[model samples]
Target: MLPMEEKFIYTDEEKERSEQILTELQDTLGQSFLENDLPKLRNHLSRSIAANAIRRNVFGLNPILCALQTAAIAVKDIGLKRDSVLAILLHQSVQDGNLTLEEIDSRFGEGVSKIIHGLIRIRMLYQKTPVIESENFRNLLLSFAEDMRVILIMIADRVNLMRQIRDVENKEAQRSVSEEASYLYAPLAHKLGLYQLKSELEDLSLKYLEHDAYYLIKDKLNATKAARDAYISSFITPVSEHLKAAGLKFHIKGRTKSIHSIWQKMKKQKCGFEGIYDLFAIRIILDSPADKEKMQCWQAYSIVTDMYQPNPKRLRDWLSVPKSNGYECLHITVLGPDKKWVEVQIRTERMDEIAEHGLAAHWRYKGVKAEGGMDDWLASIRAALEAGDNLEVMDQFKSDLYEKEIYVFTPKGDLLKFPKGVTVLDFAYHIHSKIGNQCVGGKINGKNVSFRTELHSGDTVEILTSTTQKPKQEWLNICKSSRAKAKIRLALKETQVKDGLYAKELLERRFKNKKIDIEEATMGHLLRKMGFKEVSEFYKQIAEEKLDPNYIIEEYQKVYNHDHNLNQPKEAESAENFEFENPSTEFLKKNDDVLVIDQNLKGLDFSLAKCCHPIYGDPVFGFVTVSGGIKIHRCDCPNAPEMRKRFGYRIVKARWSGKGTSQYAITLRVIGNDDIGIVSNISNIISKDEKIVMRSINIDSHDGLFSGNLVVLLDDNSKLNMLIKKLRTVKGVKEVVRI
Candidate 1:
């Protein structure tokens, strides 16, 4: 650790700020905080904070330091120790290099060091693979990490950064940071139950990503707040009065959903703001507890639905189990007096607390004694850590974090949450570590489930684990849960290590049988030839069946092949036989980098240009570009038949296997009489298909006629044709044409 003499001393202004923070920190720590520890705590916190800035090359630590100090103060209020506070202050410092691990270990306890290390690991572990970035993948992996505070701290840090990102000098840098803060950090904050922080991050992020949209929404919201309040008050009057007359006790509050959320809903549903169904949601915070809450909410749901006609499909009952994020509420979408759809959420005070505080707050309120089965999840993570290597555990962590989870139940009504599309192997692992290891099969709701069977919500899963059954290495590829994958890998690695020793012994025995004494020199040469510098690497490969012992014998035998029956070498005889000498080794070496335009390339069929949707998985032919590359076009591609007729010689046979995941943008032109809800009708038809994603819409209406073009993502021509047919079925008496 840096000594007091070497540590940075705060300026007068900074000292004052630090002192103010110290006061609050002491309050939070209370009797646990030692007065004598103040100087050392200051040094650690300062070094960590300073190190983070310097390492990220974010120089001149005026505001950032102030922000860090403020954040430290805020986190201390949560009752963290001096080390935890210091770590929080300097969380990013290691990556920045303001302080080293040695300093951290010496200054802070191992627990603090571990937390810092976990943070570092999370940063490094994520995004190492290209596939982990998918939002679904990320959420799946996070669920298994079992460290809520790590994620929470990171989120807090991001939130703090976003609040002060504009103070960053560089324009490009500011935009980049803002975009990330909006896209990732904001949504994460919302999901984590940090409502205030989530909204701020989201609004700030939107300010950068869609400044015009953000301001437009903000302006409209500000202008309408009073009017909106009046409308809500008018709407709620009858419900409140009726409930009072009915002698039912309830509380009502008005809420407008976040602007960002509204914007996303509009974009997703392909509708304008006016068309959104549930902009304003009425939340009823009930005065009840655990058992009575769900029953009371259901009774209330019945009462509300009786008074207001509800969209049966729109009713969501999460009060019974709550979301994985700890959000619990009963939501109902009902037609109000004016026939407009309005959403209502009902929840108890305890549920509301969990919704806001999530797992951490729950732990604070009830400790581990709260019998919710979350302990099993925590145990799974600890088990995964103990049984797996760093990389293996990291993979499991990511899978759990990013996956959409399914909440199932056992026969006895115990709740079980599995990652969406989880297999029986995951269920086995969830039951117990050993069961997962020895799981051979499973029965879901008394039906024999295949090993690859995807589990659904409400399934009662029973694992069939055998003592003889072991984790298959192939399971690593198929397992969805990080815990299962990690444990499997750990088991495989241990088995491999054991097998490697056996292979080493076997190799030594073979050498002895052949009278070939394996010395360090011989082993080194063999190892180097195989691209391994260590004997252990060779043994491991041998154990893995990657290297053949017979190959070694052949290599040794080849040495004598050069000096065959003649006194001269074999090369002398070859030279005598051949009048023409072979070229030098350098001349014989092929330059593979040279792009070869083969005569067979003409017959090699079409090469799809991914830039334009060539649809290689459809009937295709080549269009030779002037830039010297063949561009494949689908037979029905607007340009294809024309290109084929013009350049017949370039066109080659292409066939479709009919499998594709990539989306192709297809333009559809619709002509119809102008009418209200024409766009809505068209959108309903397009969206109902489920397979199509509308990329953009251009509507042109003039002289009582409506004509527009929609750019939609489709899988193939069939889907495009189907969409066109569907659009024609709309009641405007319009013609749908593909453009």
Candidate 2:
């Protein structure tokens, strides 16, 4: 007899059940499953379930094993390889079980284990990080550095969850997952070239995010289904026959616009769903080789457009320059037989496969990453991570991978894609991180603007950079892309740290000039004496010229009442010795003897120009020959040249002596619907005293509408927070906008 079989852990029934799943897969996949793939799938499930069983002892849930089986079945139907199928089977093993890397490798081979490891990395997002949701997502994208397959499987898992979210008992959990599916996964799927998955995820998300709205749209779509189908059929049938007659073998199918899509168009266009033109679409799948696909598709497009009156403006040639996601299709909107607009897409079978599978199939079949041209995309992310703090890394990681992209071009005629609202800083960094770190200014579409200039589509950005000009902490406010923000933040931190060290040395040198030896300890003590907790705090005050080093020496001298015998030389005279001063008498005399006219000057009733912001130290020039006699402006103001040209003889140079003058208030009319705290906040910003002084304050609100105007007195026009930053912070202030 054969040697007695060793004792087995699994019972016969369990073995048979596992075998049954394998048989079902074989029956479904047929010869496509292959012998190697069949053994791999069976063995993968067996080892994975065994590992999950250990986890079940503690957590008491083994749904991961079932999920694996389901995913294997799903993927098998797609004719995926053993590696991808095995990845599906063992994806969650490490997440749920105590399986080590060696255990996985021993059972599933290195390739399979690596994919599983990627899955494990993705799973860690849910557990390892402090942030549970978005941060987890952020970590997931960042961790794709080691292996990207984990992300693909993770997306697949998300798609599966979206499909079966109703099975979840917790409504809140269902909603959360649904929203995540919609917000994160759907867009990611689209980005990865998984068009079908993207569409499904979006449809499922819409179902939950706005159930009532989704259902209403679904009902309307269903009502028009017959008519829409008939129209699509009539439209495609002729085209399909013509293509066939031309010896082109192509498959044609009709598509209805998704509810979410229809709703979006309606919302964006501000019209009813009925107003949507391309509610029905026709997708043509051509049986052409990969190399000839684009040419053939264009030919097909020409033929179809010839038959139907093509809307020239509506044609989208994605085949020429595919989306960042590698989605390649020829799209056109044409007037159909019924005189209504219809959309059409033409692509090859291979293109359709890649579009549906996205990055998953790219690796699953080709054994490489997706070619949506994200090689550099991911490299930038990894670089950002390696060079940045966790927050910066997370920000770059999210924006690069998940943010909405806008395609812009360079002067060299190269296409550069950026996130929506990305600024010139983002473009600079995208070109070279150093350029971004040192970007001072740029020209967008040939007009000089700040680094913070918001980029628009088709604008050619020329980054003006200087190694001497480092990023400022203030750049955090305007740079929208994560990469630029992270680089700016890193540069700012480094600069601040360097400045801190330099400030310490400068302070010590200054203290030495005062005959005081300043050590770190002495500086700390001095800061505490000044109610500051740290020496850097004191240094910052000195650097900003808020705290004078000379004053510190005096304070120290007063506190001790005697000098220490240590013969240390003090630093040179501090900045305070050179006080802020006005123009000298000689300089003032040179400017046409401009003086406060004691006699009513013949043509000079001076009023400051609202736009030019002329302060006391500014080089002022007066323009006479205006309604407001002498319109004082900064000499470099844009309007100065125009005024000087029109009335050159009337222009007069003006200067302010170092004297405090009574403040002159400027009136700013704010026109926004009145709301809570708006008036109070505006008054607070404009008034020094709690009491608001107004020449006239008007208020009007009718039928729940509200708007108002406040006229208040201030010391000078310089203190007018009425329009810029302060007014922007007020609630319901639609426009703090200068009038």
Candidate 3:
């Protein structure tokens, strides 16, 4: 027996509206789409829209209906593919309806499911928390790394949202939305080559964020609309006639500047609307083949400039080298009717399509197999994501995203693009992480420059490297790219890990000499006795030679003795019980104020010379003195020459045999502008480097300038140089010279 099958039924109105929408989609997508995929797509969309009709009041509109409309716009208006349209339609399915990714995969395909998954992730990021807007935007870009179609859907969705923002009633919500759209979404659209969408987003955002100013400009524009149109007609009539006589197929159209753009100009120039020149642009779109676009565009530029005097500085030739986002157009400003400045844009029909629809049109006009223009951009986004999450990383990511790009050349004549204000160190890292780590400096156009040199366009750069050079922590402040900073941090962490392991081994060997087993408990006890919070901290101190291993061994020995003889009577130790025998009378007379050396070198005593104040890690020698047993002097000290001349044989070869725990004083002189925060800023910079300790500071401010001397305690020359480099990066610091 056959079971009766149930069929889903649609109401008369639902069927009529669904047919209408499908017909519209057919008209926009052409007959091939209707014959191929429209029936199944229509069935799914109809059910999805019906299910979502109950919760369609977020902005007092049906979200599913709006989504379908947006998808159709993406397909017909923006020339997107069938998968893109389907993804757009179901982007919110999981969040809004009973549909799941599994069901979508079964109905549509894996491609649609993947795009929908990316879109859902982005939506979840938005809905989670209002943390850092820049971080959220960065994550959004990172999401695009998985599927670029996600960004296209997001742009289309934003366009639809901006179109319907006027229906929302809450002023505060509207303002918030507008500000985000202006600052974040508009910039993204611009970066993606969606010129029309960017303009609309910017204009709508300005209308909501600055309502009063927007209306004032809008009213003024309306008041001058008739006059501006007449002027445009008069200005273009002569150019139109010339192009016609030249047998060129072209259509010239007038474009009014967006309100946001005009507002920005007014604020920058501090002028009223009337003072703003070139309020509109005339676009001349030529009908030419893809191969002839560049030639025809330039030919049209010649015709337009022949009618008016062109501003030399205002001429932009983008036809030769398109923008990074794939926008191709030639622009020029000229003195037009009534001596007013008028801007003109010349491009072929293919170029016009790209400018209008952005990458969407690029894919369609260039065919599906053509190279995707966003691979490099996606790579950068993925790099940032792999760098990890933090406020500093977010700031670097934003800087890379929004800053203007500059083009430079390698020694091999290959062109490379980097963000403006990028230093040579950043360029090195862009080539490879290893190269950046070992970079000493570089040569720009055959002249040597520091690694901190800001690169400019068209400069030939050659990175100089040395096998011994390594990345210093201070390089983080010098390199502008996020990738460089991330790599530097990783390298430093790996080095520290290795050093920590070596320190642990050294401590273990010392413990073994005392006949004590080195275990976790023993290590913990030692860390507490040494005032360290963790074993790793104790190990790091040992590795840096900041803490003496002998001191650690003595502490553990005391514990060992106490545990073995808790009940024994305490006995006062006499001077005779000391390990070192009393120095001979001759030794006492020779050593007046010299401190006692370690037990291993019991017969010797020495004091660091005041002339050099030699610290740990310095190349030093011991000098036998009449009153002092031995005086330690740096190898390059000023007194070394005089001493050698006076008593050459008195000098004996000496090196630091044990850890030096005492601090050594060093002086630094700084000169800079006498700003209010100059002193505090310098202090802050010095404080941030953990290895250096400030002893004292003396400053004199006069005539809007300041000179200061700082006495700081440092272990070695490396720490001193690092501190000096950090001080030089301060805002008012002009010079940081070692005194």
CA lDDT of every candidate: 0.60, 0.61, 0.68
Worst 10 residues of 2 by lDDT: 576-585
Please identify model 3 stretches exceeding 4 Å from their true place. 1-19, 30-53, 127-145, 240-253, 283-332, 345-739
- For candidate 3, the per-residue lDDT at 711 reads 69
Q: Model 3: what TM-score?
A: 0.45
TM-score for each model: 0.43, 0.42, 0.45
* Model 3 Cα lDDT, one tens digit per residue, 228-295: 88998999899989999988899999877888889998998899987676687898999988777777
Please give the lDDT score at residue 71 for candidate 2. 58
In model 1, the runs with Cα more than 4 Å from the true position are 1-22, 44-81, 91-102, 126-132, 135-147, 167-169, 182-191, 229-238, 285-330, 334-341, 346-739
- Tens digits of per-residue lDDT, candidate 1, 589-701, equal 22111111233232332344432344323555556676666565566777666666787776555445435355565556689987766776676566456677654455677
The residue-by-residue lDDT of candidate 2 on 90-133, one tens digit each, is 65556555456787687657866766776664554334222223
Winning candidate number (lDDT): 3
**Model 1 poorest 10 in a row by lDDT:** 587-596
Candidate 3 whole-model C-alpha lDDT, 0 to 1:
0.68
Error of 1 at 451 (Å): 23
lDDT preference between candidates 1 and 3, better one: 3
Superior candidate under TM-score, 1 versus 2: 1
